[model samples]
Target: MAWYMNSVEDLAELYNRVKEKNIPIERVSDHGHAIGIYIHDPDGNGIELSYEMPASEWGHDPSGYMIGGTAKGRLSGPWDEALARQAQVTA
Candidate 1:
């Protein structure tokens, strides 16, 4: 199950909350057009809490799907850093 977060700030705050609660994080994945904080539900279903890139930054595939390839060599931009860049992004 994937839940979309409204902004990087919301995602970053949740990241901090998840850490404080000591919940095991599955992974933080950067999917080019989105960033997700993944974890499992109590019933063991995989859950992705994500923030998508602005419409301007999204890419479309020739096949009609949104581009979602992960970045090569180290996933970039954990929640907090991404949140910090929101200022630049909005500017």
Candidate 2:
């Protein structure tokens, strides 16, 4: 149902482009381990584009499997910076 993206840069780029084109973005979210950008299709189905924290940054179990809970929070990062830059550009 969600989590599809490679990097924050890619997410920011897509988001900015969408906004520039006046397309509606459903929402954005910062889940401790990842950043998610949500959008809706013409059909009204929701899609999530996200950038996940690298494995090296994640907590690992004794056997080396990554384990942890994602903290739900506000949207942030390169995405926020992107919005700011757009504001400056349009102003």
**Model 1: how far residue 71 lies from native, Å:** 5.8
lDDT of all predictions: 0.68, 0.68
Candidate 2 deviant stretches above 4 angstroms: 1-3, 59-78, 81-91
Candidate 2: residue 41 Cα off by (Å): 0.9
TM-score of each: 0.62, 0.61
User: lDDT (0-100) at residue 66 of candidate 1?
Assistant: 59
Model 2: lDDT to the true structure: 0.68
lDDT of 2 by residue, 1-91 (tens): 6756677677778777777887777665666677877788788888887888776766677897656636443336656654455457769
For candidate 1, what is the TM-score?
0.62
Candidate 2's displacement at residue 53, Å, is: 1.6
Lowest summed lDDT over 10 consecutive residues: which window, candidate 2? 69-78
User: What's every prediction's RMSD, in angstroms?
Assistant: 8.7, 6.9
